[model samples]
Target: MGILTSSKRNRRPSRNSYTVSSRPSSPSGAANGKSFFAHVKTALSWTLGLGLGALLLVGLALGGLHLHRLATTSDFFAIRRIEIRGTTHFNREEVLKAANLQVGVNSLTVNIADVERGLRDNPGVAAVAVKRRLPDAFEIRIRERIPAFWMLKDGVLHYADNRGRTIAPVSVGNFLSLP
Candidate 1:
């Protein structure tokens, strides 16, 4: 009974004892290769989607331009009527002649800035605004110059504004009642 019992030690495998295989192990290596291919496929799909989206946007812009051209040139948007507002000194026909706007003309094609400049060239007009009343109308708003006083200049009576801008001359008998 005094004899020492012989002991057997259970040994675990060391970290360096694991062998590196040349070929991929069954499931893990296969999954890794599949994931790489899936990533490549997703990247390619995204690239193609972006490219197509850009092309679609360009096509839409071109289509919109064409549609705008058609709409502007068509008779549907032509000027069927010209309406003048705030006109007291000048007649509607005179304003229209200055603006060069005629019925059956394309309203969208009318240059409003040019019309305004032309109208302002007249001495009777103090301010002018040109606008397109969509679909078939052209609207012209004008502000005429007001006479501030009547003066006898060069043996002739003339109506002048505050800025000393001489308006039309009048007869003595016509305005003799005024002070």
Candidate 2:
């Protein structure tokens, strides 16, 4: 009777038929058939958050450096002295006043290139150099425009330099004659 019962149990199920039913399968069957895009959205959010945080940190560092420079340099507010050289036609006071540089003004407030440009704007000045002498000083150096030739155009006196740049025309009596 025991041998007959074991044979009956072994012959119960066939290849095509079983007591348990197979659940219906989906193309995206992982985790109850969710799409792949749902996973990607979560990963991108984390990456973007980290990138924005890093950018903010860099901006703050640059701002701190600029503020420190402003605090340390006295040149940021005033100039203490002015030095002039290589000039004869223009007096020291005339050039300084024209440059709009004031004694005791902030050194940082002045643009040396701009000062040189202002000096050159004077008809008599050929070239100009504006430099910081350190601690509390500015140096203004200039070269005078030399007369190389004289020309009379319709009775107007014009002076030309060696390079043919014409100086301002004035009365013939005051016009410099080149040697």
Candidate 3:
């Protein structure tokens, strides 16, 4: 069915300032009654304003939550344990010392770049990967420095890894036993 239509005598012009007159009183005011486009434009403007405000509020709330998460300490809620693997040139103690990593430090506080720099400082470590094992653990996987060649000086022979750092001393050993 079509829209309900009222008798011409039953409806009165609206008192709203924006509402147009039902009958044109002059030549310039040729248009009569509210134009379909004018009603659509007013409705759209109201909807657009409301929508924009709602979006802005949502954005601000999200930003605040993100800032809070960044500033708060996650370590208090999570525990971290570390395990080292694939190390041969350096002992566990030496590797740990070089890494400068403390057991009690928060995993969230772990800086990847800093850890990498510290681990690389160890002559026996060529490369390292530090990973967070979720709620309670961290894992360090290292590529042990390779024994590239042996150098002899002052009647003593020293073993050098891939980075040419002395790892151990040897007097007389076969070349095959270097690495």
Evaluated with lDDT, which candidate comes out highest? 1
Ranking by TM-score: 1, 2, 3
Judged by lDDT against the true structure, how good is candidate 2? 0.74
**TM-score of the candidate numbered 1?**
0.63
What do the candidate models score in CA lDDT, each in turn?
Answer: 0.80, 0.74, 0.71
Q: Estimate each model's TM-score.
A: 0.63, 0.51, 0.51
Ranking by lDDT: 1, 2, 3
**Which candidate achieves the best TM-score against the true structure?**
1
Q: For residues 1-179, could you state the per-residue lDDT of candidate 1 as single tens digits?
A: 47544542345333554765455655645454566677789889999999999999999999999998998899998888888999766777788889888899888888889999989988768888888889999778889887778778899888777888876687643342333
Tell me how many residue pairs clash in candidate 1: 0
lDDT of 3 by residue, 54-164 (tens): 999999999998976764456562445678899765576776677777666656666768878998876556679987776567788999767778877577887786666
